[model samples]
Target: MTKTTTRPLAELQADFVRVGALLKQAREDVETLRRLSMAEAQAETLAAELEAIKRQMDRAFADEDKAKEDAFIAGIKDVRITEGDQRDNLIRRTFTVAVTRTGNDGLRDWETTAEKTGLTSLKPEEYAWLLRHPDRIPASILALADDPRTAFQTYFSSKKRGYFRGA
Candidate 1:
């Protein structure tokens, strides 16, 4: 089994504060080095070092935000708003997923194949007629339309959205 240790919230906050100070000092150092008349090779080395530190700082901030989001998600479930002030800025945690088509079967020229398969043969008039007469629409299509999950899989994508706002 893997061993685990938990630190107090105070310690976590202290660690972040120390990291912030280190990032501030590293930035100052980079600015000071920029002011100096250094050789090209030396300047490149310093710039690379600064860039690495900046990446680390970015990761640190991202991790911190993730932790905050996790905590907020856990805490928000216990709270509710029956009635409250409208001016307060409500904060919330959100998650999203992205999907991209990965098949590489020369799909760029699929229109011709689709048309030949009668997939794209339906015209605006046919669609309007279908809408006017739902009974004519296929049972499968009607069933899928009634089911959000199936309809989402067939028509929508993997993109997700969420936001925090006043009620």
Candidate 2:
């Protein structure tokens, strides 16, 4: 046997109001979660777009630098201009691996000597490291650090902002 129960009209209405409030809160929570998910998706998309823009910027800068270097070299090689500065050109200091250009056996000799001396050949990272730790380096090896070579570095300048150049 089961007992039956009944509530007064006012009580039932109160119950309905409480249940309705709970339902409403649950609906709001779901909506909030959906919005958060959408925002995350948007953020991910934006990050990817930003990365793509960075890659494009890097490529554009590299292409421009190469073009500038090519033009500078060609001008010199073709004797169109001697070593001098032009309108966007400035004399820039640079370093190269201390190796001789003394004909066919020169490169081989350098490699052998470098290996025998336990000296890693000057690569980009090695060169940067050398520059960074100048204090730790000895004078003999340091003297091999060639005089700053002159390069026709290209650049632009404007009154509004200032100078701009590729690395």
Model 2 scores a C-alpha lDDT of: 0.45
Residue-by-residue lDDT tens digits, candidate 1, 1-167:
98779898999999999999999999999988876756687889989999999999999999997676554333121111121232432212121211111223565422111111121233333333334345544343344456433433332222223221222
Q: Rate the local accuracy (lDDT) of all candidates.
A: 0.45, 0.45
Alpha-carbon error at 16 in model 1, in Å?
60
Query: Where does model 2 exceed 4 Å of error?
Result: 1-34, 78-167
Q: TM-score for candidate 1, please give it.
A: 0.25
Model 2 agreement with the true structure over 1-167: per-residue lDDT tens digits: 99768888899999999999999999999999999979988999999999999999999999997676554333121101122223432223112233222223545532221211212334333333434345434333334325311111111121123332342
What candidate 1 gets wrong by more than 4 Å, as runs, is: 1-38, 75-167
Top TM-score model: 2
| Number of colliding residue pairs in model 2 | 0
Local error of candidate 1 at residue 68 (angstroms)? 0.8
lDDT of 1: 0.45
